[model samples]
Target: MQKTFSEKILAKYSGKSHVVPGEIVEVIPDIAMSHDNTAAISKTFAKIGVDKLYNPDIHLVVLDHCVPPANEAFAQNHKDIREFVKKHGIKKFYDINNGICHQVMAENGHCLPGTIMTGSDSHSTTYGAFGAFGTGVTRSETAVIMATGKIWFRVPETMRINITGEFQDGVYVKDLALGIIGKIRADGALYMAVEFTGPAAGKFTVSERMTLCNLAVEMGAKVGYVPPDEVIFNYLEGRAAAEYEPVYSDEGCNYDAVVDMNLSELEPVVACPHTVDNVKPVTEVAGETIEQVFVGTCNNSRLDDLAILAHVLKGRHIDSSTRLVVIPASSKVMIDAMRLGYIETIVSAGGTLATPGCGPCMGNHLGVPATGEKTISTANRNFKGRMGNRESEVFLASPHTCAVSAVTGKISDPREIPVDMALIFSELRKATLSPVLMTR
Candidate 1:
């Protein structure tokens, strides 16, 4: 049967030859991930009366959200998670030193093409960049997956997003993602599976591809995917586990909707104030003063991302009025940036490099903005109070824009400055370092 990339993978995991949209199937996911919220998931697991995990090895837990624990309550939560891991012999566990759950999975080898993985975090869709079918589930739902290794899903209809044209200098994948989300609106693809294709998609590296799928949830998608190809294959060759089959969409497969985007016309767009869909070209809002500029998050904090910032900030410092904060997505990414000297470049340019974790992006830890202040960040969300005080504003944009704006203390257009494409590409190439090996 003809099927989209997601449908094909779902069918394979459900033990079927074919599956249709809206069909409910029981799928045994290749991996189930949880983070600091694992404490809550553990509670649900107990309430469900499950004494042992269906397969402890398939379960991954990472402590990140409030790393080091903000206070006593959070400290106890981490303690509960550690106890759970110890008692259950969960071998895939990662402590605070690891970083964001999504990045940990990708940097390691847990998320691979042709496999379906679900996490309790919304950005679980980030794994789709590696050609895996990734979706977010509730903590309770995660508990069930831990207990049974199986979860039911309604095969979502597919949305084909085809792009043709090359990005102009100074524009990055983060800009493209924000543009797509803005055009599609917040709920545009509700419960649908989005598949990226076309010349533009082909131009993206595995890291850039992650930005596309990472924001799929912003469009209300159940999951997002990119078909496996040589680019992704090369990325996974040494990093991904060797046991899974690769999956892709058939040529004649059906799609519920098709959106064609011309990349050449895309600009440095930002999601303003209170919504991911409230986007406008930076040109439309330039000169809007900002108090802080953040350049890392699960959606944009890979090694490549930090390298881009370093390249942009080389021999330059941010505006004295703006506080620049940088958080590496994971310790693996952080170590790589340091080895490449990108960390030094960033710090020398006045960017504060925080530990590997989701710092300040969720307003739960460091770098939270003050009331009435404004921040420009690479994070996926821009809702009120998302990054600190409710009165403060958050604007989402590409790392290039975020860095350049940090220099100006305002919403700035990245295109206003000449970009050294050669330098950026060199950094991007160096960014694909091998994942750090962790002992089981």
Candidate 2:
């Protein structure tokens, strides 16, 4: 039988370097991540007659969820994780202060192209941002790989999503992801690998592209990828670059599905409460007063994202009815934002800046929306009770949208904001068009 392109990439990474279905690949994981939510899984591994961890160096544990643990049970879980990391000599323990595991891992170069990765959290798929074949597993499964240096994957069919057209001002990667998800549905790409390609994706910065691929599992995808280009190499080079070849899908690779997106006429999008796939243009729900607006998290905490927000809210103050909270993804991001005057600008404009960490979004550490309140955020999930109050409603949007929401006290469309978004986009285009053309 003729081998498919995806099969070829997996084959090279497989222990034997050959194409075979249902065969467990044994490649080394470039990175592994876990959080307090899955801390119990680490205990389960110990109970299964596993005394020592597989690869202490490769294991990365985060203390995100249960930050100030909601209750005794959650607090104990974090405590257990701490003891385990200490006992195993795990050197990569990021306490609650380290921000979100996914952001920290990628920004710090823990995951890179062609590397295999696993994490206990379902969002582990976020590492696909680095062009790695990454996914989630049970804590025990993760532990076994930590020891055995291998894991299994059921070869999945591939889907190629080509995004084209120019983007409207104020729209961002988050909007594109929501647009894609709305079209594809929660299970639209079920049991498949989604490979985003073409001009639009190429226009995105590495972090923006990462934000898109990180949500692969939201549509039931097994994995998501972007072919390694200069953006990928630049982010990887001089950080964690190595002398190794990466396998790419053949030029004529077979695709189980194909989606063509033309975002030229697109507007900022929002995912309504309780479902990421329930996407609608921001205009549809704008002006509905909001109680809280959160900006930060592993999914949308890049400097570029913050810069965009700063530009949007440079002279505006939060709406009297809305409380805006900004949490950087890491200590580094916070420090840099402060050094660049973004932090001061945000604070003086009535935004409360938090330390570098994942709490507001996690619902365990930072501000929790009051019951029945409405919230807007730049975080990944907008599922029920995702950010603390079960009765509260959460809408997902880009940092630009979230920032404007803070000022308007409602879900906002960036294009409608007082900011000069059109000029912003025009200048952005001129400044970036040259480099993109050069690269091509």
Colliding residue pairs in candidate 1 = none
What are the Cα lDDT values of the candidates? 0.85, 0.74
Taking all chains together, the TM-score of candidate 1 against the true structure is: 0.96
lDDT score, candidate 2: 0.74
Model 2 scores worst on lDDT over the 10 consecutive residues at 431-440
User: Which parts of model 2 are misplaced by more than 4 Å?
Assistant: 1-6, 16-28, 66-76, 241-244, 418-440
TM-score versus the correct structure, for each prediction = 0.96, 0.89
- Which pairs of residues collide in candidate 2? 54-146, 54-147, 99-357
Best by lDDT: 1
